[model samples]
Target: MSFTIAIIGRPNVGKSTLFNRLVGQKLALVDDMPGVTRDRREGEAKLHDLSFTIIDTAGLDEGPKGSLTARMQEQTETAIALADALFFVIDARIGLTPADRAFADFARRADKPVLLLANKSEGKHGELGAMESYALGLGDPIQISAEHGEGMGELYDAVSKLVPPTEDEDEEHEETDEERAARPIRVAIVGRPNAGKSTLINHLLGEERLLTSPEAGTTRDSIAVEIEYKGRGFRIFDTAGLRRRSRIEEKLEKLSVADALRAVRFAEVVVLMMDAQNRFEEQDLRIADLIEREGRALVIAVNKWDLMEAQPGQIAGLRRDADHWLPQVAGAPIVAVSGLMGEGIDRLMQAIVQSYAVWNRRVPTAALNRWFEGAIANNPPPAVSGRRLKLNYITQTKARPPSFVLFCSRADAIPQSYLRYLVNSMRETFELPGTPVRITLREKANPFAHKRKRPN
Candidate 1:
């Protein structure tokens, strides 16, 4: 990114709506309610020819010290400190409130180039409010309706002036497979309410980069941050806690759950956080099942391990329980961690990297067929309805969850239990532990069946 810009404003001023439009994606959750966004979320913004990093911050509001609102304000302040420019957004339809006046001074105190944006500026009401904003001393307000994108041209002109010009660069190079492989591994930390997901990410980042609290579902957005462990780089996401479906009541929480699920789908590896006191609970199993169903690599992190007694064989017990609870992701690595104290952080990271590698693992065709034969020999696909099942062979179709296609005489006749056996066997043979292995049954194409017979 050439320059960083932060969008700061009072609640329900359409800051997030503007952020989604600038980023060309609905990356930020937008709602009519105030303070839908808490943590500062960043995205690459492109306006015509200009490209830069844009941050969406929480609503600027005053609250008691150490409260969630206060922490959110702290997040906004941090974004301001890191930005080269500020977009002071105000509701044009509603006109300036005390918050707009207060935060206008806050933005001015930052001493950066400020662009006063009168959001919701789409009509005569907007024009009146934009005219009212001139008293804030933040210069002429740019009237732009974030929802309808009415004055994007004006927004572009103002933003372009603040960004410094750079010499035309060389042509961009195409990314190679090796370079892609070496890029940061995307990992999402997900789990039930207050399972230390944010705490673990904060420890890895070695800073208070993400908001953490005893309050369940404190994180409303899927916040991603980059970190380097040892020599490898990773993009880790701190997501909102997921509760049982019956328990979700609020509309905002539902949106938060959807955002977290989106993060999981985008990630290469997902770490399922579990409270040590309540490990392998029904909800934890459900989450693990969801991760497996999504076909992402799984790593179980038993959090708050420091509070547990140092009993011998406790690690083995956890392993046994994990396999028993989540057989779909059997052999997945389980690490006991204390995110608050940073214990087992290194091991957790190692497990993540290892699981990612396994998820993308592929076996050569020769080796794969050999394993298929041996697996069939050990426990053949059982007969269904007294008809013998002819298993021809199997080939790996893809990786990144390691999918396969098995050619057989009767595709439908092959029971799911048999496929499960084959998957487990392949995992054991190829050392593909933990990652979800998919085997799709297909009937071998009969060449003559496609063509017309002689005269029959």
Candidate 2:
């Protein structure tokens, strides 16, 4: 394993800013609000020639036992334990507060190599704050502005002394044809609280990689794990159960929900798991709608199927309910699976793969326009303000959910119902089901209409 560094500080310090700078991406959500980060987010960081794994941790603070703050502190502690070194950041503008001193003692007691960073040290106040850090007895403070990308050379020098050099492999990232073609499929399992999302992932993994309990909201972070199912590589993200907005009072639970939403946004295929006994609830529909709106490939997994007694017409009823409730994903594949009994897992995986394939499907422009002409001929666009709306042509702009742009004379005049009709028609004609299809209307600019007529 490579050397790992953990960034720890009191609330509102520039830890996240430095983490984002090192990683060269805004992976962690940065906000002026204190305690924005509550979990340990890891990313590969490079400073000039040095490369190591950097962990962005939640602000260190004391809270009541079993509370959300306590859990966040536990996550930070975990990151501290995992790291070979630590970047203890302090807001230079504020100098040092009692909380900063307290956390400084805590970091020193951890017995890891600590790098003192006086962040936001761009002005006179910042310089004074950096000078005050010397009293903490960690080491000489590295005055730097994480936001402005200053003092990186000094920061690099400090890190270089602590961590050993690694052989450069910039070119090794080029993948072979076989390796490139066999990339892991990213799937996120999401559902309401106590819906057995963790149980389902544990069953698929054939081991307890996640902490599962009868208690609701056991998971508070979106955890990703890799597994191979039937020779196919899969990276599945098991997310925290989403409760109603009114029910979520704690700030930490809100962050957890946000993290789960990010996982959904990052995923290619989303498995919307639901308890078979209490299927198609209000929250379930909301989540399904969210998936559709995000334009992600979706698979509905009715979990805990083994618990429910087999009924003659139960399957048909479930199918009808899916179609009735979620018309947006009209033909989305639904599979019945028992995460505990390990039944119907193969079918669920197959459905996920199929949904992903559908999401990535593309239709030829010629065939698309041909179907468009036929669809318009069969049911012409409705007249707007006593003038018939003229649809010039249709062409797919992009794939991954198959977005199309329709050129028309009066684009704004076409009603939403008409667009819905065209989308449904395109879905049916192109054999596209379940995947979200986006249709954009564009008015062909009439150059001659603007020019004044020369004759009479």
> Model-by-model lDDT, in order?
0.91, 0.88
The per-residue C-alpha lDDT of model 2 at residue 456 equals 75
Pairs of residues clashing in candidate 1: none
lDDT of 2 by residue, 1-456 (tens): 789999999989988899889999766666777877765778889998889999888899999987767877887888899899999999999999999999999999999899999999998999999999899999899999999999999999999998777778667587886884499989999999888988888788776556566878877668777789998889999888987899998776887799899999999999999999999999999999999999998899999899998879887888899989998888888899989888999999998888887888889978987899999999999998899999999888887888989999978889999998998888788878888999998999898888988997
Task: Report how far off residue 276 is in candidate 1 (Å).
Answer: 0.5
For residues 329-391, could you state the per-residue lDDT of candidate 1 as single tens digits? 889999999999999998999999899889999899999988888888889889889999999
Candidate 2 vs. truth: CA RMSD?
A: 5.6
Error of 1 at 341 (Å): 0.4
What is the TM-score of candidate 2? 0.72
Which numbered prediction scores highest in TM-score against the true structure? 1
